[model samples]
Each structure stands twice: as C-alpha cells, then as structure tokens.
Target chain A: MPRATSRATLFEVAAQADVSVSTVSKVLNGRAGVSDETRARIEALLQDHRYQQRSGKRQAAPLLDVLCYEVDSPFGSEVLASIEQSARLQRIGMVLSGATEQATPYAHWVDDVLRRQPVGVVLIACKLSADDRQRLRSRNIPLVMVDPAGTPAPDVPSIGSADWNGGYQATRHLIDLGHTRIGIITGPADMMASTARLSGYRAALDSAGLTGEPELVRPGRFHHADGLEQGRALLSLPDPPTAIFASSDLYALGVYEAARTLGLSIPADLSVVGYDDLSIARWAGPPLTTVHVPLVAMAEQAVHLVMRLNDEPEMAFSRIDIDTTLVVRGSTAARNISK
Target chain B: MPRATSRATLFEVAAQADVSVSTVSKVLNGRAGVSDETRARIEALLQDHRYQQRSGKRQAAPLLDVLCYEVDSPFGSEVLASIEQSARLQRIGMVLSGATEQATPYAHWVDDVLRRQPVGVVLIACKLSADDRQRLRSRNIPLVMVDPAGTPAPDVPSIGSADWNGGYQATRHLIDLGHTRIGIITGPADMMASTARLSGYRAALDSAGLTGEPELVRPGRFHHADGLEQGRALLSLPDPPTAIFASSDLYALGVYEAARTLGLSIPADLSVVGYDDLSIARWAGPPLTTVHVPLVAMAEQAVHLVMRLNDEPEMAFSRIDIDTTLVVRGSTAARNISK
Candidate 1:
C-alpha cells in the first residue's frame, strides 16, 4: 500500500489487485456489487497508485458536499442557508452532513462522501483527517473550508470572517459608550478565530489605557451555557463591570439570561455587545448590538472557490477573510455612572 | 398530451416518438445529449402514456430530496438537521432545496429533481402544484410533507405535531394562571397548523368558561415583525390582557421587544407563552415557556415515511401527528394582580 510516485491507470490497478477492470471501475465509482473485502483491497490499491479520475467524467449527479459542525447551530444554519442558495443558483444539489463533537465527520462520513462523488466538498468550521484528505485527493475531489477549526493546512484554502477586527469593534463600541470596566466572554482558546478575537479585545483595552483584569475575562466554548455561567460570575463580582462583550450572539443571549436571573436589565444595568450578527441577533429581545460576520459572502466565496478548484486543481490555494463590522442596536447603551 | 387509460412500455413510447429506444432511455434517465425539443416531445408522450420507470431501476445515486420554505429558519434548520442525521444513518445523501415564498418550489425545481432522481422527496412545510405532483407521480417518486401548508391533500401523507393540542395546552396554561383575558398571536390563516392552533385556543377558552375576544386575537405570519406589531397593538388596548400566547418562538421574541418598549416586565407586568421549543427558547432572556413541537420525531417520521413509500408505493398513506408538550420556563408565571 506504499504511495506511488506516478499516477496509475485503472487497468493497471485492476491488474495489480487481481480483479477485472470493471470491478475496479465499480469500486472507483462507488457502485454496488463489489464485495467489502475486495472493495477495501481495491480502494487501498487506488489510493496507493494515486489514481485520479479525469475531470468532467463524474457519473453522479452534480452535488456539493457540506460537512458542518452542529448543523442546527445558529452559525452553522445561516452559513448552510447561504451555501444552499449559492448551490441552487448554479443548479447543483447540496448534500449536508453534521460533523462529530470534535469538529470532524464521523468515521463512515468519508466513505459516504466517496460513494456520493460530489463535485466539491465544503467544510463549515469542520476538520478532515489526513487519511480522509488523502482519500479525497486520490479521487481528485476539491475541498474548501469555511472558518476552519484549528490551524488549517497550508495546502487547503479556507473562508473566514475578520475575527480580530470583529472583537476589536465590539470592545471599542462598548469603550466608546463610557465603559472603562468591561467584561468579556471569549470563545474556545484552541480556535484561531477565538484567539484572534481575544487578542483584539486585549488590543482594544490596551489602546484605551484600560487595565485588563483577569477576572473580567471568561473562557467559553461559544455555548449559551458558557455565556450564562461566565456572565453570572462576572456580574456577581464585588465591583462588576458596567458592560460585557460576548464574542458570539448565542453567548450574548446567555448573558441576557444571566442578567435576568440576577434581576438586572440590559443596557441600563449592563450594556452588552455581541458578535456574529446572525438572524437571532435581530430576534434577540433588545435586538442585539453585535459584530456582523460576513457569513453570506464567506459562504459564496467557499462555493465559488470549490468550483474554481474543481476546474483547476493545480491552482495555488488561497485564504480569504471577509470583513466584519459592528451593528449598533438596542442592546448597547451608555454606561450609567449613577449605578 | 392527454392522459392514457392504460400503462405503456418504454419501447412503445420510443416507437410513438420515432426515436431509438436508447434515446428514449436517455431522456427517462435524465442523461445529456438529447435536444430540449426532443426531450420535451418524448416527455409528453411518456406522460400521455403514463410511463412509469421501475422503482428499483433508478440509476442516480441514492439520495433524498428536501424542499424547505426557509432553510435558515429555526424550525426549518432543526427539522433539516434531524432529517440529515436520519439520512446519514441510513447511508443516503440528502439534496436540499429552498422553496419559493409561496411555499412551492421554483419552476425548474421539479426538472432538477427529476434529473437527480432521488429515492424520494420530502417537503418541509412546502407544497407542490398538481402538475409538479403529476410529474413526480409519472416517475414513481414518493413525496412526503412535514407540517404541510394549507389543507394537506388527503392522498399526500404529512407528519406534524398535534397543533390543536399544542394551542389548547398553551392557552390552558395561561388560564390556569388565573388570567381570564389572554391574547394570542396566530400564524398565517392559510396554514392548517395555524388554524388548528387558533381553534384549540378557542376551545380552551370555551372549556374554561371564558368568552373569546376578537380584539385579543392577532394574526401573524409567524414572523418577528408580526409579533412586534401585534404585541404593540395588543398592549396598547385600553385594557390589555395580562398574558400573551405567541404561537412561534420568533414571535415571542418580538413580543418581548414590544414589552420592553412599553416598559413592562415579563411575568411581573405580563406573562408570555411561546410555541416551538427551539434552542432559542432556552436562550431567551427570561427563558421562554414554550410548547415543544417534536421536530426530531417529525423529521424522522418524514424520512422513514419516504423510504416506506419508496419500497411499497401502494402502501396506504397515513398522516401522523407526534405529540406536543408545554415546557415551563422563566417567561410565564401566575398573573400579577398588583398591575
């Protein structure tokens, strides 16, 4: 199963595997009839030989595969909607899969994708294992990631929002509203987007000549419970900040709950700023003031990139970051010094 | 082309169209190379002859088609996630399409579906025209609806929650809190779910020996704006109800905003009840008391029904309604007499 330096034809692979070329073709095309044991042997041979199917020779219907983390999450759903719309405009069907809790597809997902033989794969805040990547490569399937989890491979292109700028804008909005002591709810530490956002928050605080207190910063996995727990802890402090910057809209909702639990009102008692202006941001009670991540543009870019890469697989991969902006809404207000 | 009284074979249709059997086969299988005019002519002849492809003979990849009104809507997203998971577990791909504003797919949607030749089609709160329905019927494709709009055709089985029960329970909860005057935000009139809920509300009032007030019943399209506008109107009445029953979670959020604008506190000033216990329900500032529509179960049922229909197309269509339950949370409480 050692990798071959040169490409091997289907006939050659079939000969090496001691199977008919049609059997090898069936395995390559993901058609049924080949036994599991034989299919696995042929698959390994195909991978080792680095067999590449000619472009435009796909037998399956035009489909774009999407692997997303938490498909029902606000962020995932909105991005999926954008991608679905883009794919529809191009008359391509979209096949969606939910990644595991670790942000990777389940063990059988790659197998399913291979069988489906989609034109391209789009991952939204999801990751693919090296073996899975090799499998797709052997099949000549193009993949593009949206807000990839962890450090993305240099060879793989990705689309993401300007997280640092978003974090800075959210913090600056609060600071501009006369908030010197601001609490923050940061996303998971491991995610680059989260780290960048935290860094931006720190930069904003440093530029404003405000001391960054460890107690004012809380870590989270971008879950509502994280926001609620950290928000409660922050608001319960002896000298609580007048404002809080929640890095995600879901987190902001959690902060809202925390405030309500403690009998505090938004803006008046604790001005709040959130990030990722998803539709729920507008549906929030106070119509959350937050940083708007350009998810629609990012989704469109990911789809377009997939198409481009499918056509020209040799093109150099590129990373794209759409701009982010602060949306002023009813959630943020001037810090009331009287409190 | 007039409908034929008897089923016709492919060879007979090819003979009538003056085309080779292989050419007719290409058109039936949605293969390329057939001219549009010729394809149309052949399709009409096939339809006139009521040509039906063998169910198991579909050559397209195993896929299920989904047509949703708004793929990004909280309800739609949740349902889609459930279906995707179900499809994944069954080793089938789901092809998603967003329906038009009218709750019907676009003109070319049926054509695209035919080309894809999915195992079956699932409509999430979407509709199909008679012509489109006939097209799917001609191809022997199964169709199932989840929470269908309008009166579902008796022949087309649909899966939905116990809307009447849901509405009754919501209104009953408010009545149990000793609030005799309760306002309701109703969904669109054309939707059976909305009418069922509205009827349930009336029944609950009748059972509680309370007269329903026309002024208190507000119409909405299950949108945030509808809730906000209707909530404002209800609250501005000379004598406002102490409790509001928002049929949708988005509407509940809008009502929350309306209450905020009017300087009223939830539960203390006015209790609110919402339907569809989406994830946002838990994240609501004062966690919303909502009717839990079993979206996961409904989705699973829709997917399973599609599969069943595909295997046994003659199986009698059965409409299933999963149960709904009320979830008590921070949003609703006993009516306050002090106000």
Candidate 2:
C-alpha cells in the first residue's frame, strides 16, 4: 500500500479526486458547492484513508489570534504581554491585529478574525464600544477580554483584577486613618473600571459617616499629565481633602510630582494612594502606597477561561476578579488634623 | 431585480442552478466528480452573481504575528505595547503568542503561527538556543528578532537598542566628570544586551587610558535584588570605584537601596549610572543618572522591519541600531574629596 503515505496534502487529495484545489478547500470547510455524490465520495475516501482535515485535534491546537486596540497609555504593553503569556501556555498559534480606539471598527476586525477559525482570541479590551460588543455577540466567538469588561456577550468571558474591591479597600484604609475629607482623581468616565472604582469609593465614604462630596470628586482622563493637573486642582480647593486616591499608579505619581512642585510632603501634608501598583509605584520618590493587582493570576485565569470555552460552548458568562493587596508604603499617613 | 436581493444565499444559488445544496457547494468550490460542464456553468453563474464570502476584505489587510516568550519583566510589556502602537499606525494585524524561555522545540510554535500565513513574525528572542534558531530558520518564515543578537540565522533581521552605546556613553559620562576609577554591575552573561554593554564599558575604559579592572566589575542578573547584592559587593571593596555603572535601571535602583542601607549618599559617597532609563528612573529618589535607550523607537523599528519584510521579502538581513542619550540627573557626579 506504499507504506500508507504518512500524511495527505490538499494537493494530493485534489489530484486524486480530479478536482480543483478550491473545491477541496470548500468541501473541507463545509461550504456549499459540491454535489451530494461527490461529497459522499470525498467523505468515504477521507474515512477510509484516515485523511481528516479540520479534525478536532487540529482545531484544538489551532492558532491564537490577538487583537490590540491602541489605548494611548503606558500600561497597554503590560496588558498585551500578560495576554501573550497566557496564549503561549495553551500551545496555540497567534495572529495579532492592531486597531485604534477611534479609527478602527472592532466589530469588523473581530468578524474577520472569526472567519479564520482560531482556537481562541485574546482581546486587549481596554476600549471596545457598545456596537463592537453587539458584533462580537452576533458571531459568538470564544474570547477572553483583559483589563476591560466584556459587553455582556454570551460566549465571551472577561478576567480582570478586582478594581472595585481594590478601590474600596484603598478608600476604606484612608477613612480608617481618620480622614473625613478625601478626594479622588478618576479615570475616564466611559471606562468600566473607573466607574466601578468610583462606586466603591462612594460605598466606603458612605460607610464612614461621610457624604459624597462632589467638589472633592473630579474626573481626569487617566494620564500622568492629567493626574498632575487634577492634583493641583484638588490641593487648590478652599478646603481640600486631606487624602487623595488616584485610580492609577501613574496618576498618583503625577500627583506626587504636583505635590513636589507645591512643596507638600507625601503622608505628611497630604496623604496619597494609587491603584495598579505598577513597578513605578515602589520606586516613586517616597514609595507610593498602592493596591497590588494580581496581574499573573489574572493572566492565568484569562487563558483558562478561553480554553474552557472550547469544550463548553454554552458555558455561562464568567468573570474572574482576582484579589488585590494594599502595600503600605510611604505615600499615605494618618490625618493629623482633618476637616 | 428585487433591490439586488442583498447578495445571493446558498439556497438561492442552489435553486438558480437547479442543483442540491451540497452539489452547488461542490461546484462553486470546484471540487472533483463534478462534470466539466457543471463546473463551467457554476463558475459562470458565480462570476455573474458575484457571490463572494464575507471574509474577502479581511484577507486583504496586513497581518503580523508576534510570539513573546517572557512576560514577567517590567520592560517586556512596554516593548510589546510599543510594537502594537507602531503596527496599528500602518493598519496591520498583530497576533501575540507568549511562551516560556524553558520551552523546547521553539520552532514548533513558530511553525504553528506561520501556518496562518502571517505577513511576518516578531520574536522577543530571549534565551533561545542555537539549535532553536536553526529550527526557526529551517521553516523559511519571514522573521525579525527583538532584543537578542548574534543569531545563528544570519539571514533573519533583528532590531534592538544600542546597548553598547548606552553602556559606553554612561561610563564616559562618569569619566568626563573626572572620575578615573569606575565600577560596573553587569547583567547575566548569556544575554546579548549584557555582553554588548560589557564591551561598551571596556571601550570606554580604553578610551580614558584606564585598563579594565576585573576586581571592580561584578556580574549580577538585571534585577533590583541582584543590584542590591552587587552594590554592597562594590562598596565593600578596599578602594571602590568612585562612579558605578549598573547595566539596567532596576540594578541601579537596587544600588540606591543598598546605599541607603550602608548610609552612603548618591553622587556623594558613590556615583551611579544605569541603562534602559525606565519610567521609574525619573521618579527614583534623587532621580537616577542613566542612559536612555529610546524604547518606543526600538519597538517601532522592530515592527516596521517585520512589516517591511512583507513587501521586500528578499531584503537583506538588516540590523537597526537606535541611539541612546545620557540623562544626567542626580545619580552621578565628580568624585567626592572625602571619599
């Protein structure tokens, strides 16, 4: 039997069947075109010769497709690395697509990705919009969104650190330090994490016999430069809050820069805290007191979620919120004389 | 024409051609077993009706794949993000795959990614062995490596910051400041960056009429913890070099921590310079005097190099060397007379 030719190429199959390569591809893809008689013959030959193209095993080890949307932030790269790490562990091939938040339509790109039939997708979902979410849902592709909340898609799962819990704990810690008047420098209003953290801050304030002071709560676009501006604005208030909690470590670092410019010492004149606890937080002039999100754990969870979706196609939407820790550094202190 | 009927469905095509659904699919796909007459007829119909799949536009877009083997490092994320940003500007798709340095048969993953027919691949080439490089070269995939040098596959293109220039510039800056005796903290020996930096240090010493001192140079992994150990080791020497150049910013930070522990002041008892002026360098206590490698530029170049390969597949192997600058901050100075 000529040693049962180890593997059959598409060329060999097309030549043997006296068909064009396009026809073989169509039949293999289960697209409409071949006659019933021809399909039966191809199927019979495939079964007899054990020539299974698009086998479950092949699809199981399919390529990893990645789509990265530009977020104009320093942390975007970190998130991409985390997703890439997870994709590698699954032994999947990867394709990367780049899009901007404004110029590219994510839904169209996602639809294109799905046609390639990748094993799974890791979307750096920092800025996907509502319309994009609807498109993803319509396709029902298995996806794991990092850093941003998925738009309530049935098959798409999301994994991120517990930003709300982190925010709550950070705010509660400030309150526990005897600060009645606190301020917040939030991320963009449209961001889910920003909104969630704001809610947590409100919850903590309410629990501490304090009302939500609208004056103290200001929104910034979550850039270091914005943080600096917001910091200056907060300190300039008639009765500024004793402590400030910035949503991102970079923002908090900006606040530190602002404080430096104003000669207000951290943890002494004004207490400060930050989220994401990026590497810079530890080395900031007087190490920043911030919440440490479990990035590696989040990465692992994202990969697992995507892999599981392959088996449980109808799996319920899952959200994994990894726990965060408060690293008490030199940035925050007990309010000596609070308002 | 019923408003052009919103593109023909499979059912419509089958009905129009007086064929079963499977037969129509087969004929459209040009599979064998269909008589010549049927294939020609189906082709004519498809051409007339313009029944193309939805994925046509997607296939036309540029697709770039990346495989990242390490994600734990702080700089890793930043580089990946930069690449994505650069790729996005060109309207390219990037697939990211993460793998561990310890993984064997690295080429297998590369092959899997190549099967998708990506325009080219950018490998974060850390710790890949000669054998692995050989395997990757054997695949005939258009490849560009980042951060690793001296690849066995000479034909493959690479892009990285001028680690040698960074090191030499840092050492010479210290020398120009009238510091004759200089110490060095080197990164891991096996890393290309480490080696390049070491050569640069040697060149700087030779230029300053100072022979390389083995006693003054200590090998340390490029981490803060190792930097601490190496910093302590350098300080304990009978006659420590007045100025110290640590291969990485993390290592330089470690030196700061060590100096604090030993009651030594920066640029007073000890002068320190670092490489890869990471974000934390400016925020570090008494901001570090370091060599600034244009990380974003390097990443952009890597992406451009890979993308360019798609258009010029036979382009000669290219090596892009980005410039580095000496960011003089508070970390280095003239030798202290008391010391």
Model 2 C-alpha lDDT per residue in residues A1-339, reported as the tens digit of each score: 221323355567677778877876655544457886876555455445534233245452355566655432445555656656666666665556655654244434654553456666666654455544433332334667776533334345677777788889999999999888999998766667788889989999988879978988888876777778899999989888889999889889788878867878787898899998776676565678998987777767777787777666557776777889988898888898733
List TM-scores for all candidates, in order.
0.93, 0.72
TM-score of chain B of 2: 0.75
User: Interface RMSD (Å), each candidate?
Assistant: 1.9, 5.2
TM-score of 2: 0.72
- The C-alpha stretches of model 1 lying farther than 4 A from their native spots are A1-8, A11-27, A30-50, A58-60, B1-8, B15-27, B30-48, B58-61
The numbered model that scores best in DockQ is: 1
Docking class of 1: medium
lDDT of each: 0.88, 0.69
Superposition error at B237 for model 1 (Å): 1.1
